[model samples]
Target: MARRILQASFVRRAALSAGWLAGLHTLAGCAPTLPVVVAPINCPVSAEQLARRCQAPQAIANGATYGEVLQLHQLDRKALRDCAAHDRLLAEMIVQCQRTILDYNDRLVEINRRIADKP
Candidate 1:
């Protein structure tokens, strides 16, 4: 009777060990994931240069236009020139220029999203 009890205890321990190992094996099959990385946007001109150009009217009316701003990936020079030509305050021009920079950045983000969403 003692031998039978020992055998039963051994079998129960083996069954428990097998169950625990099976659970571990199942968990091992599911691997941990890493965060996804995205590429940065490449702009042609710096924000400071764009802001300075926006503050200068002659620079805008002479050659700077919306097309030029878009091509250079800069602020809206024409809008800045219009504001300056209308005798807007220097502070206002700066604000408008900064707003233009934000607009440009938003546009670039949208473009990047569209490109990324392509099938």
Candidate 2:
């Protein structure tokens, strides 16, 4: 009877450990994979210029009046339209920079929403 109890306990512990490991394996498989981003090479534009242009929209988004927002949108549209006529690589960079600015604006909107939600 003593030997049987010991063997049963060992079996139970083994099964528990196997279940735990299987759960971990399932979770590892479900984990999201990170995206890989590559930077452009041999570009004509300087990083400083890109950074400055990118920040332009964010500055407006941060503290612009309704009229300023309208003006900024017009300016952004004109700039992107002009960029579309340039070299393909430069146009792509301009579009990417515009996307970054829009994304920043989206985050700022979300932050404002959260702040307004707070008591």
Candidate 3:
């Protein structure tokens, strides 16, 4: 009788967990989806704006922002050798362009706050 009771309790707990997992999946499925689109173009400097406009093709030329780049600063020796053969300036420009975007966003937020305070 004791063994029977233990088995019943285990089955009940397992069923509860299964039901909870199903509910989580249903909730996740209800989330709104984002569209896959090209990145925005709004650089403060026209040179940087042109660079932003040309980023995709430049990235392809540099071949530096691939799956391997996600490994952080630890690049494979062979890959680094290959990248050195390509246009290093392209990668540098991309990094600078991204930094400019972050700075621009910060300045815009500050300017909007000042404008809002007037009225």
> By lDDT, who's the top model here?
2
Q: Model 1: residues >4 Å from true position, as ranges?
A: 1-88
Flag regions of model 3 displaced more than 4 Å.
34-119
Clashes of 3: 0
lDDT of 1 by residue, 75-110 (tens): 446666665754445556567767777876787777
Please give each candidate's TM-score: 0.27, 0.31, 0.32
lDDT of 2 by residue, 22-99 (tens): 999999987654333323334346776455432233246676789988888888877776555544656787678777
lDDT per model vs. reference: 0.64, 0.68, 0.61
In model 2, the number of clashes is 0
The local lDDT score (0 to 100) that residue 10 gets in candidate 3 is 100
Q: Give the local distance difference test score of model 2.
A: 0.68
Candidate 2 ranges beyond 4 A from true positions: 1-86
- As a TM-score, model 1 comes out at 0.27
The all-Cα superposition gives candidate 2 an RMSD in Å to the true structure of 19.0
For model 1 the local lDDT of residue 115 reads 61
The CA lDDT at 78 in model 2 is 75
Candidate whose TM-score is highest? 3
Ordered by TM-score, highest first, the candidates read 3, 2, 1
